[model samples]
Target: MERSINVLALMKDGERFIFLYDEQSTPQLLQTLGRYAADPEMSFSWYDAAVLSQKVRRLKESQERTTPDVRRSA
Candidate 1:
């Protein structure tokens, strides 16, 4: 069975954005999107949830603030 394409939201450097295309697309998909990636500055690449998760992790790690402690005040 072929995996379907699903648009997903991805965050980079605290910025949120949407990414198009399915993460499980075959090599043929790469060939199809090659034109979009031809530019040196702007290019589209396939990024799965795992990859995106890592990026989010890194962003969280790089932060210089302490995690907020949720507590009830008397």
Candidate 2:
């Protein structure tokens, strides 16, 4: 199935950026957008939703790698 996502807003100042997506979009699309928002390189550069989503995913993965894993063994 082909789904369409609308980009409500894409604002950036200096190194910071904010992306707003339409509420009608699917959760999968939203998840993808979140991924791109975390990228250091692509975070600031995205032409479309698809590309942005890719960047967001990469950014999220990078963040996960740096995050400390907490587990307790009993």
Candidate 3:
């Protein structure tokens, strides 16, 4: 079993924003995006967070649809 690391990046107005996370860390990543959006000094905006969050959710959903569930009954 290998691990998958998801990398998301955005470059705008000469600035680059990058995030690395696994499926489990997505919520934390979303929170971090919110924090960035709230900071007045950064160029990151709520729209950016919303867009990225949608992307993250879609990726997760696609993965879920492809993977199979295995269970044992005793």
| TM-score of every candidate | 0.26, 0.38, 0.91
lDDT score for candidate 1 against the true structure: 0.46
> In model 2, what lDDT does residue 33 have?
62
Candidate order by lDDT, highest to lowest? Answer: 3, 2, 1
User: When superposed on Cα atoms, how far off is each prediction in RMSD?
Assistant: 13.1, 11.9, 2.0
lDDT of candidate 3 at residue 34, scale 0 to 100: 93
Clashes of 1: 0
The alpha-carbon deviation from the true structure for residue 4 of candidate 3, after best TM-score superposition, in angstroms, is 0.3
lDDT (Cα, tens digit) per residue for candidate 1, span 1-74: 34445444645566565645544443334344444345455434344344544544454454414434335321
**12-66: candidate 2 lDDT, tens digit per residue:** 5644444544334446666656567457667544355566666555655775586
- Tens-place lDDT per residue, model 3, 17-74, is 9999998898999999999999999999999998999999999999988766544322
> How high is the lDDT of residue 28 in model 2?
64
- In model 2, residue pairs whose N, Cα or C atoms come closer than 3 Å (at least 3 residues apart or on different chains), thus clashing, are 35-56, 35-57, 36-55, 36-56, 36-57
Off by over 4 Å in 3: 72-74
Off by over 4 Å in 2: 1-17, 20-47, 72-74
Residue-level lDDT for 73 in candidate 2: 25
N/CA/C clash count, model 3:
0
Deviation in Å, model 1, residue 25 alpha carbon: 28
Cα lDDT for residue 12, model 2?
A: 55
